[model samples]
Target chain A: MPKVTIDNITIDVEEGTTILNAARKIGGRIVPPAMCYYSKLKGSGGKCRTCLVKVAQSSAKDPRPMPKLVASCSTPVQDGMVVQNLTSPEVAEARKGIVEFLLLNHPLDCPVCDQAGECDLQDLSFGYGMEETATEDDRREFPVIDIGDKIKLHMNRCILCYRCVYVADQLTDKRLHGILYRGDVSEISTFIGNAVTNDFSGNMIDVCPVGALTDKTARFKSRVWFLKPMDAHRACGKCPGKVAIWMFGNEIYRVTGRKDQFGEVEEFICNECRFEKKEPGDWVIEGPRHIKRQSVISANHYEEMKKQSIIDPIAGEMNKQE
Target chain B: MKSLTNRSKVVSNKQMTFWERIYFPAILNGMRITFGHLFRRKATVQYPEATREFSDIYRGKHVLKRDDEGRERCTSCGLCAVACPAEAITMVSAERKPGEEHLYREEKYAAVYEINMLRCIFCGDCEEACPKEAIFLTKELVKSEYQREKFIYGKDELVESPDPAKRVDVSKRQTKEVLEFKKDKRYKHNK
Candidate 1:
């Protein structure tokens, strides 16, 4: 166990817990936004450096504070460590610079972008980026890539967070896609010019922090704010079918992995639920409206593997489906 | 009260003769002034047959611009509607369907865009506010209509020609100040 004091608030955590997780345990108003850190995926942290926080003191064994601000997502919580986050002026300034760099090559075509409302990059940049860009240099541009009929990759929106790559390799059963080249010309591409289509390619779009990757079926369909997400799922032969059905009017527009109250997808949904199961009758309605965070967990217990353990509504619904 | 000097108040100098009182000379002077105007350029033009040349900055009926590829440039972000002082602009946006790229410049396109010409002041605020360079105030004046509903211009009437050559050309309407602002290269991807 490790006892750490972050911003005068002390907390205890398990040995391997990083400062970002320790901040999450501290809870209210502390967790620094992690652009590259997906908690479910291992080794997805340390790349973004957006969660930098100062360590004012350390354990007696070290006896000295760290030389520079450390990335909170990767730094292990040392016993008796003193961390300064939100209240620290230096950390906030550095974070503003981090956000500025993330937005340096990002296109300002938010009007046409599908991820305008629910985008993490949009929210973070609005919260931390400079109002006016200091650089007058030309921004990097890339042609939009359509990877099969399922996903569209707008490389201009990418900040190279590696969350999608991490999900594609670690969370799913494929590694056909990865970043190619290096430096400013780096791009996410399929291996040997192959099309990046695997069963779980749909989830990559959900894990993306920007509009870099998007659901082709749902692209240019409806703005996220206008669409109402409902709890819906169906019988599946392969993976768990539990998912959120986004609808506009009477039409079921699209389906994706359902997120819990924390906005993280609770379980990775497979392609059958995302693409093939499109009709209204293919699904059994799970719970009340999924528009609010409080209802997300209650509405999301339909994952097939865990279907029996949670509740037994399938007996009646199975007859209904048949 | 009387004038200080009698000469200052001396009535019509020397009583007018009867011939002068008839005022033929005064009538002739009025005719001369009227005839002078006839020789100068005509003030009223014969409209419909011969149109008057409007000034360069004349803001008239609105036209939604299309890109050179003949795709509608408006993503329907509603900036033009928000910028309109008279609240004459209204629009609805929809996602671009697959294979519709040639019809729309972006993933989102204006499903319905309308402007109430009766309420619009033609101030060109919507023109300046548009980020995609989609909407412009053209030199074409709004025609007089018999019904209030007829004054509203829908996307069908507002959109420019799909043919690039026949498209509603508003380049000549932009001022020097606007041209300088449009030269900003900070947002390359957007341009």
Candidate 2:
């Protein structure tokens, strides 16, 4: 175990432990806005670059040069390591640059996106991005690519974060994704015209840091702000882990991996648990007046009649039988 | 077989009054419109010689990214492939050789990468799928070809030249420092 000082606080961690885990052990003082890091998983992979930290050695006499600012999620802890996270010019600049890059292709369609209320990218950009972009032309125009029946991919909003692919391939053992081409020509795709048919396909919508990937059923249906989020948990209908579901007005809008149960590996519920939707019969609706009331007063009268029927044995039995 | 008709209706070919006979007014009107256009600023741009100002976010031709050390940043992680709406990109992964560390930044590198320009819809999905900043869409849209085979672009053509302005100097001192700090005897064994 190595004792490292992160943001001036000292903590002990095992070898190969990333700075992010070490920070978490010590209450996460040096917080980075990481969207792709799943503690249940083996590697942070450092795809988002949001959790950057500057590190230095504790001993001034050490011949080693100061550690260059690297992603905290990727860099492992070292003995006598000193990390500086707050007010560091390098980290701030990196954060600004990363935010700008993430927002570079975002469609500014927050007003309609389902994740707008809880989107990590939106919150981070509001906290870090410049008021106006210097870019003058709208570049990268391509017709939206439809991967399959379940997922509606809006490529324009993607920031290239590989969380969906990583989860799908490494954690879930679904090798559904691969990189094609090199440089800016590279894109994630399936073989030929095969659509994404994984049971956990809906999780990609939740895991996507941007609006690039979305649920086809939920698209253009409801805005995030308009719906209320209720915390609900259900036993994994297919897998061992329990699933955390977010409900909006009795409708289950999204399902995700529940924290505190498992680490990043298999951190989320399996594909089946994540994509399950409540059918029409799943909801219970009450009310219609016996007299066929068209207005609120008549509706109230109908409710009274029902209450009266419940009190009367014959009427109650008739109503119940019907 | 062809049939020729000798029957014909009477046709008049008479010259008209001043405006019709001379066609001066209509000619003048046509000339006025032509002259107006000629005197107006020509919107025609001589392409290949003249270039239009594109937006910073304008996605055009793809450019392969290099790190500060001028090393390729792609780790051959197939995320971009999964995110691509169009299956236009294809790549094979190759492990980096010991001495070739300067060429590639990651242990796993993209060995063969090809893009079917003919099939690509220029959606910038590939640019969005890259995690290492290895790929970008440059503002070079004029990719025309006479033959279909010429449309595919390989790694040799995709890697972008290092931007002189964005270059960072990683001195030997910094490199040595990084090496010493990363000198846990464990990493070598794991590798």
Top candidate (TM-score): 1
Candidate 2: docking tier:
incorrect
* Off by more than 4 A, model 2: A58-67, A172-174, A235-237, A259-266, A279-322, B1-191
- TM per candidate comes to 0.69, 0.50
Error of 1 at A218 (Å): 0.9
Candidate 1: tens digits of C-alpha lDDT, residues B1-191: 78777667555668888988999998999999999998999998898898999887679888888877788899987667666788898777887779998999876799999999989998989988887888988888899989999999999899988876788767787777667766774554235
DockQ of each: 0.26, 0.01
lDDT of 1 by residue, A1-322 (tens): 7899888899989998999999877765567888888787778889778889999887746858889999999999889998999989998899899988888888887888877666778777887888777778777888787876788889989989888898888766768788989988898877765776677778888888788998888776665655567788777876678888877666778887886533467778887788777778888877534443222122332333335524666664443221
**Best prediction by lDDT:** 1
User: Candidate 1 chain A: worst 10 consecutive residues by lDDT?
Assistant: A293-302
lDDT of 2 by residue, B22-96 (tens): 888888999899888977877977876997787766667776778767788776655455455676777766656
- Candidate 1, residue A61: CA error in Å? 4.9
